[model samples]
Target chain A: MTATTLETDLAGLVAQASEGAVTPAQALAEPHSLGLLGLTSLGFLRLIHAVERRYGVALDLDDDVSYLDTIGSLAAHLRERGV
Target chain B: MPTVAVRGAPGAAAPLTWGQYAIWAAIGRTAPNDHYFNLTRVLTPPDRCRPLDPDTALDRIGTALSRHPALRTRIVPAGTAPGRAPAGTDRSAVPPGSAVQQEIVAEADVAVRTVAAADEATAGSAATDLVEELAATAFDYGTEAPVRVGLVLVDGAVARVVLALCHLATDGHGADILLRDLRLALLGRTGPPPGDPGTVVAEETSAAGRDRSDGVVDTWRDAYRALPPSMFPTPRAEPQPVRWWVGRLTSPALGLAAAALAARHRTSVSSVLLAATAAMVSADGAGDRAAVLTIVGNRFDPSRRDLVATLSQEGLFTLDTSAADFADLLRPAWRESLRAYRSGYYDQLALDAALAQVSAERGEQVHPMCCFNDMRLVDLPPGPAPTAEQVRAARAATVFTWAAPQPLVGCRFCAHVTAAGPALTYQVTGDTRYLPPQRLRAFALGLEELVVAAVAGPAPLAALPARLGGAAA
Candidate 1:
């Protein structure tokens, strides 16, 4: 899968993980959402798991999921880590 | 009384392992004014299943509880001389746990009191017969610190399970784990099979095996000590009312929405849920000044995996929503959540004390003047999932009963998120006169909506769009 599709699909999954209907584009555009930078610990795990599945790679122990503290960070990390 | 046992049949000073201790310490930090996390539930024919023989089931439960050290442990500060009575105390509490010997259960770690025929409809007009039977059944259950296993038989079947643990012993997750284990024991299932996550790891055995990790209890103290002791959930109410409610989102859509929100916010379903709940609670004029209580399980510590361990700390985050726009409120809410994350270390004692004092003068529940607990956050893997109907019925019948009235301040809501689905249950008990049953349910529902709307949009737009449930409305 192209890096763009991976980000798109993975970002889509994170959006689904939340409750309201949120477009990934608006989420990307919003700063208020920055606070949501931290999901519940378990949700955090699932997000990581989703990224792993989308790209067909276990999160590199080196990738540091916690470092994806923000949506921007998560997308960038996924881009670099998406095999 | 030789501490060691002669042979088998339950005995050991199995201390709380790193994971168990971490969790209990966490529980001790986030508990309410009273040492009661009284999470009682009415077991249906399904829940009541145990060895056909009642005696066998009791023994089995006893034996099962006996195996876990955390269940037997209690929390006493780390250096306090055992039984030497710390200041203003006469109890020689053996730390946060106590051992269980199979001697008719002098005290139950958790009592399983039975009240046969509590299934309401089937249990018609049998109050006289049932009450008489319950009185007889009650005798079989112990009433000491660690409650003995007490299961009631209604019309010949196991009915209500009363698990009253010293709040210091278990948290919501621990209670769930204990119940599932009890289910296994009743079935032909042998002791936790290898890899049964519920199987108590050696490290988690408490000092007597309850959750006697008093030292671990101080994690939140340090976490909160770092913060300014600010009053929270402003306009704190006293005689804090408490109530319990059970509600399930009832749609695969909720799960999907969660995934979508998570992807958009770059957070988890829980954050979405919490942010939503927080918004709902704050929606009324109440959101303008109140700070809801949240207990974040800080199993973040690497050495622990008792994710089931109920250890959690209290976070008294101040959410100032007096901003001009939706984003204004959302950004600060986000910042507050992040601050809470940074100071996730919770102190149950502090939380309880804060609630106690908060309730002492105001008219609101202190611990969570209104809780927005997300149980799905725990992540129970999907097994043969129960039908939504079964899960819903079980939750509906049991949620209201979990409320331990009076002496508690706020009404608390916990959302247990399972892969099968998310179940939201609230436990409230305070003043029945002030907040009646109808009002309690209404408050819970309102609170649920507020949290979601808040997280879905920004300032001046706290409400979700019409397409998304009209959050603004």
Candidate 2:
């Protein structure tokens, strides 16, 4: 997927993961820990569900959590995985 | 123990939010458990550069009381208790709500106990005892302050500081904030502490404009009436003392196993854990379908993420382990968990009405007695991370320990799971009468075994070794 499309989809998932505690623009802000923003494991799991459904790719459950710590990194991880 | 001094005047009274109202109701409905009142303890060891002195500690507490409105808040009798709802009433049920109202005292006073311990050991023991006493004793919120301060001194040096609060005043998040602010206050920081997030949330939630449907009162009502209660063994007529038994699996291997299961099942570790818990519960004869109440942090909204308030609420889930395969349960378990988290923020009065409806229909009072809390995000202090081999050996050793005694009010079961690096600690508390020490140990070990087995492979629930479920025993 193109970087632009990936960012949009990943941002949406982060927003959903936060349960609207943070907007997509706010979550995409660099260097903020999603944990502090209220992205709980449940949230991350839900984000996984959304990513799989939208991109039709599976996430390794053991994927390094640092990649999921921010919207930017998660988007990059997905791109690397050819999502 | 003699009270050294009582420090402020009665402040203005405010209405209790639905969240506070629910806690007040639970306190009134259930048998008294002092553990519920113990909010947080801020301990300062001697190693800290600036240890707290008795005078400075009291000063900091005084500052917190004056700065935060909730810290000074207490529950006073409002009008005559709302009349009790008639049987068979659902949403139509009315309240014999407690005759209590939240009033923020303009001035909050704390009851202080100054202990002059003979030595460091004495100081440590005294501090521990004082905290237990403070947490267990029921506070007369209408007359007494919701917060209590205990200062322990060794050789005239501040050895430890304990601050215990009532649930009515602050939730876990708020307690942590109070602790941080107290530390700042010790450093001589001052001002009206951060704005009262509790007030903001209450105002917004209680607003007439907010949507009530999101609370999903009906979903909870249906679950309460339909799901089977978690039947441990026997229903004791009298409340029994409570005890805590903890088991830890501090292995990176367990994490790896959980991740593999989650990946294979296309779910999260939490879902895997929940499904494993259900299998353990069913094998222990708590029935094949265990209805559990999950504690939702309720910090999903960014606005309230840093707000110091009692936003945590209980979401009810009925996990059916009737499926022989543990893997089969993850999908359904995940769905139920999500639904529970979404509906965790229902109106207290509506929940009460639902409880009344279920009670009348069942010809007995029914309550969700089992609680499962995932405290991974609660930000507990981290401990040393064990090596993979150490984690494996620790799991194999399987040692168990009882936490210090706390007052047990009734027959309530709760499991709080905390993770530090690769180590997982499952602290399980239950009324000893219902779940004797042996039974509780078995239950805890059974849970750990399920995780170990799941990590080994995609084992179905019933296909796992009987020893894991304690069934072989």
Among the numbered candidates, top DockQ falls to 2
lDDT of 1 at B391: 31
Top candidate by lDDT: 2
Model 2 CA lDDT for position B443: 68
Interface RMSD after interface superposition, model 2: 8.8
Using TM-score as the measure, the top candidate is: 2
Q: Provide the lDDT at B281 for model 2.
A: 60
* TM-scores, one per candidate: 0.52, 0.74
Count of backbone clashes, every candidate in sequence: 108, 13
lDDT of 1 by residue, B52-82 (tens): 4465666666655654444444333444344
Every candidate's chain B TM-score = 0.53, 0.79
Query: What lDDT is obtained when candidate 1 is compared to the true structure?
Result: 0.41
Query: How accurate locally is residue A42 in candidate 1, as Cα lDDT from 0 to 100?
Result: 43
Q: Provide per-model DockQ scores.
A: 0.10, 0.11
